[model samples]
Target: MPDQVTPPPSMHWIVPFAASLSEPCQHALPRLADAKALPNLRRLLGQLQEVARIEGDEYALSMPHERVLAASMGWPDVDGQLPWAAWWAAQDGVKLTADAHWGLLSPGHWLMGRDHLTLLDPATLALSETESRALFEAVRDLFESDGWALIWGASQRWYASHPSLQGLPTASLDRVIGRNPDVWLTDHPQARTLRRLQSEVQMLLYQHPINDTREQAGLATVNSFWLSGCGPVPACTATPAHIQLVNALRAPMLADDMPAWLDAWAQVDNTVLKQALQAVDAGKAIALTLCGERHAVTLATAPAPGLGGRMWQSVKRLTSSRSGPDPVALLNSL
Candidate 1:
């Protein structure tokens, strides 16, 4: 079975795509919007301590959540170059050979814009299990001939283990959504080999029957594969299973559908945030980590214990003469 990331109810809700780089989403979001609109979310934000902030450029090679995952897993290079395949393969009980490194190779479409090529969302590929297996068989020999061990994890997830993966930095699939790969592509010399491999896959796929069928059906054809989550498997602490990850806005945000995003956010605000506030009332230590293209901010339960503690906090706030960060401003910028 595919590993679904569900952390425990000590519940650190990692909300991905909480903000967007698209103008439509940027303009139509919690930004400029009143706090009263999302009461539960607003209350939760006010209640939690703004503990950690991981900031980056929106154009960074990895999404902010990737950095969060790496940190939570206690790995080095927490800046987003996560050894995703190695870690995922480990979860799937795939053996790691001596001195091996691993990476995820996702087969998908690359649409040529007027000037640069943009990678489409992999979900749009709609590859079925049988079709994915067939495509894998066709492409496996190429990777094997290049001295790599490629294994199938799922229709969308293919794993490749090789020593060459060490120190090769590629963008997270989340980071590359609807964007050109060129900007985030690493300057590492080893990247040339992956580029060559990608070109080979494109050429092979161009004449494949799957593309012909997809084209006839008015669907995007699978043209190439993306290499990401590159690194050698490292000794790392386990991610606490109690931390929950809420991905309600991921799909809508990635598709650039602001309306759908608003709807989903409403649902999340009603369901997830409502339950989160309830959890707080029950005195469970929970948190909300809202992740955007460039940053992840973790809002944890403040350590105030009683009325006296609360009064002290208020006094400090007054002495500092600084209000807490405006939730509106933070979400808007994110």
Candidate 2:
């Protein structure tokens, strides 16, 4: 007869994008500032502090979302040059050309603020597949005319290929949304040419039929495109099989919509975190990594200790003058 014993629970990894749970500006929003708003999140943090162990050295400050994804795929330290466009294109079944650089071309609105221009969140564009393809067709010649190849992938995400863009470092879209674009533009030697291309594309799309239709509908016009993740395919090591990511909060966080951010957090807490807790209770190994704008905190299920080990830990705790770092404090620090 086969063995009747069940295997121990496998380790699971959870990554929540843009929790930025304790924003300084949130103090102004009463609903957001209330500790009662995200009960499950707070509960999860408390449980981790009491039962799980924290790995403080894993924190990454001011880290880009793409860098996290890259690291999860075993490609850490690629930072600003992760070649996300190539990865996305491959995921969409698009073949790449030899020695060509690929970039994500997202249609977005650039709002003219009192002092500077802000790139509004791309999600607000509400661009449909047909509309995206039409816009891509309208501007395809502009890129081809400039010796660059343009391919329409998914809605609001087109891929462009250019030889000059190879090895060019571009900021991730997450880093620039709802902020000034000038700061994130590449300072590489070939940036001038890329800037000129951007200008020409903007000019061409200024009065296109699509923009006219959008304007007639009182929607934000798709006046410009953001080119990022520009580079050749990056070499990566082994990719993890089970790294779960929750990013519903990204759009709201970038748009500075506090209520939406809180709602998204609630959903994650109720669904993802709740499930993780149950798994942990069932003797399953699990890990949670909370990421904010500046840092990330990871907590994993603590290993079981024997009676002797427990006694030793208790004695050590009684003799120690200092306490371990507070998980809540660490989260707020992020």
Candidate 3:
């Protein structure tokens, strides 16, 4: 007979992404050797406490044992949240993976019929069965009221396929939440590429020159960036001047809604506007407050000979003196 039964029938929930263990992770396994020798509650609890002491907050009593399992093996501390299959196995006193059978509970807290590992959440590790049941029921009610569905997937690609796509038939609830790796993973090379591309794009956006501009523009948060060729930002009638100003200050604008004032702004001359904006913004302090008798107003201050300005000046001097290439010309060449 197979050592482990399949999921659902077995009450095991797998993660959304079931990527294979990295070679390094695989190599480190025997080092992470299972706690199979722990014969009873006292030994198991002692092992867990030792793990916690070594790793500090990495291994918490509340998180799923799988995460604890990873931490125990020297994986960096991860969040306590886990998918259902892993959670269930831990609950049943089974190993977190389908392969293992050992489970852990607090020392001397084991029950005869309930032999599965009951990895407790922060609030429940020390609780009685009745208390845990009450808490689960209350949370279940809240989930139903909020229309939150409990999702399961063997990989992130399968999880994404749960939602609607261009024209394909929408998956049913069970299909949406089920761990169907065989179906989706076979056809979704694009999904993995898409995730990678999205990550790279976000990194560039975060490091974009416009972020500092928005901060200096007196804007609180730079939610998004609206590149010229991409598309127009809704409600934000930001003139070219406004975009340049925001970019120079390193502030982002959500390409979403624009307030009334931004809508009424005027267009700007791209070349001249870019130059003026750069001159006004480069290493400049723009958030200073100027007071005149009873009236106080926010003023855009010019860059002082502070650290950033000093750096800018040094660069300017170096570029001006260099004969082989004009640094400013090279910069604007972009």
Q: Where does the lowest 10-residue lDDT sum fall in candidate 2?
A: 53-62
Instruction: List candidate 3 segments past 4 Å from native.
Output: 1-87, 90-125, 149-334
- Report the C-alpha displacement of residue 11, candidate 1, in angstroms: 1.8
Question: Using alpha carbons, what is the TM-score of model 3?
Answer: 0.16
Clashing pairs in 1: 7-241, 7-242, 7-243, 8-241, 8-242, 8-243
lDDT of 1 at 71: 80
TM-score of every model versus the real structure: 0.88, 0.81, 0.16
Find the candidate with the highest lDDT and give its number: 1
lDDT of 3 by residue, 1-334 (tens): 3342111110111111111122432242232123331112112111111101121221122222233233323333322212323333333443332222111111111111343321111221233354334323333333334332222221110111111121222111111111221232213332343234223433433443443443465532221111000011112211222221111100111111122112211111133223333433353222211111111122232223557756885676466422222112211111
**Model 2 over residues 26-54: C-alpha lDDT tens digits?**
44234433555555555445444322222
Whichever of 1 and 3 has more lDDT, that candidate is: 1
After aligning candidate 1 to the native by TM-score, how far in Å is the CA of 4 from where it should be? Answer: 35
Highest TM-score scorer: 1
lDDT of 1 by residue, 1-334 (tens): 4543322347778888888768888678754356456667766766677778988988777788878878888877544368887776677666655477788888888998999999888887889988898889999999999999999887888999777777777788888878787776777888888888988998998989977988999999888888888777768635668666788888888888888888888899899988998998776878888888878898888664567876886676466422233456667656
Once all C-alphas are superposed, what RMSD does model 3 give against the true structure?
A: 29.7
Error of 2 at 90 (Å): 3.1
